[model samples]
Target: MNTQNAEMDVESLQKRRRGCFLDAFLVGSVMFLFAAVTTLAVVGVMTVKDVESRLKPPSWTSESGPLKLTDVSSSAVFTNFAYLEATTSGLKNATMQWAVQQTSVGHNFQYDRTNHWMMPVQSGNYFMYVNLNFTCTHICPSGDFTIHVGEGVVDKLSCKVHLPKLQDSTAVIKKCWTVSSVASKQKLISHMTVPKEGLDNWSLDMGLGMFLVD
Candidate 1:
């Protein structure tokens, strides 16, 4: 009887040890699984945040690039432009000396109201334009009218107008050109030539200017 009791006690003790070992293993596995899941979630969150940050648009600043104005002010408007105006009464020797209607000195651009020239103080690109309007008081014959831009020695741009019939009417001629890498202190003067005689019979009104493009 004593031996049987001792054997039973030993069996119970072995079963308890087995149960403890299994419980310890299950707890350890659960803890390891939790740690692994937490690590994966943290990594995924960090990766998503990184991608979001990368996909976001870059902020613009004055140091980054040119300013973008929703409503541009007058001062922000083109400060490097000149617009000269003239009439036939002011034309001399077929060269029109225009008065400065609107002009601002910026981007190294200037106009000589005295010499009738658009002068640039820097060597760069410019947008030059001219507008000529002609009207005949009595009659205009079929002929060509030409506009030359530059000093009398050389021409930068030449524009021509043709009248197909003799009529007492008006004609408007406009031309624009882009000049690249103009020299500093370069002069641009304008001259008009009418194909017919009798300058007194025709009237001419003109506008011209040069604006720095870059």
Candidate 2:
């Protein structure tokens, strides 16, 4: 019986030794995996930083430390433009004359008061616009009036309005266009044609504007 007990004790000791070795192997594998993941994470972060540094603009820094980006001038914000309003002086020939108001023009666009035309100095794409305001003083007949903006006898942008035969009627018309590759010194004028009845009853209202847009 004593020999049997000694054999059982030896078997138990062997089992404990095997369990201890398995636990030590599992701990080592976990430690190795954690170390590999940490190294890869650090390497990926360093690579991203290196790529960012390469992508930065050369203007971002100078010999005198980092440069302020606000000091650079941007041409996109400035635009040359002009605005003109219809004057009440020239109404006998049914042709409209435009003039720059003291508060209307912007960036010093070229204008010829004698010819009453807008002339662009720089040849490029330009936007043209016009607004025609008309109001009836007394009873009026049903008719349509056309407003034109262009060189002499050539219409570029135009708008038309139909007025019903009614007393104290009002009509507002607006037109705009983007002219591609406009030449320098090209003249543009705004004019209208109204019948005798329209001239007697319906007159052009204030705020009628013809302008050169950027």
Candidate 3:
């Protein structure tokens, strides 16, 4: 009878140990699964943010760049100047980038790099001038380079510069137009085109200057 009792006690001890081990294993597995799910959620959120940023248009500052608001007490708001330099090798048109901001900017005007244009936040009469210089290694045969203060609109101002048939020469052109009147949200930007014949081995410099007259 004593032997039988001892055997029974040993069996119970073994069963209890197995149960404790099984419980520990189950708990560890659950923790691993929870950690994996949390990690995947974080990764998914990061990927969504990246995709949204890529879908957005390329902008230098904001919906618009550089605020246009100046105090009327001073004349600084009426004075402004912007310039850029670009070189083209192919026959394609090269759009000027306002990389350099020189001179005073008024509260009524704003500059946007994404569109490469200087726009007026408030409408008023403004005296606008555009200057273009093109230097080419070879002479142009057909068309002359055209420079404009405002291009592709009804009130656009333009100047055509004749390229002399001489290699290693520079053609200089300048034009001034009184934006006699501009409605609110109107833009006055500078644009120029280089002839396909003289695009090779050439450098072009463009500048736009404006002052509020009214």
TM-score (C-alpha) between model 2 and the true structure = 0.52
99-176: candidate 2 lDDT, tens digit per residue: 444324433246677877766667666655554556666765667777776777777667676766767655544443
User: What is the C-alpha lDDT profile of model 3 across 1-214, one tens digit per residue?
Assistant: 9999999999998899999999999999999999999999999999988854432322222355542223221355243322233333232355556643323355566667678776766666765655555556565444566655563555456666665565656554444444556556666565557675554555566555555556
The stretch of ten residues in a row with the least summed lDDT in candidate 2 is: 69-78
At residue 143, candidate 1 shows an lDDT of 61
Residue 168 C-alpha lDDT in model 1: 60
List the pairs of residues colliding in candidate 2.
none
> Candidate 3: which stretches are off by over 4 Å?
1-92, 138-142, 170-176, 195-198
Error of 2 at 161 (Å): 1.5
lDDT of 2 at 81: 47
C-alpha RMSD for every candidate: 21.1, 18.8, 17.5
The Cα local distance difference test for each model comes to: 0.62, 0.58, 0.56
Off by over 4 Å in 2: 1-79, 89-93, 169-181, 196-198, 206-214
lDDT of 1 by residue, 1-214 (tens): 9999999999999999999999999999999999999999999999989855432322324565543322111343445555556744422247777664232334455766677777777766766666666676566555666778876578776777765554566654445454655678888788877644534455666666566678
Ranking by lDDT: 1, 2, 3
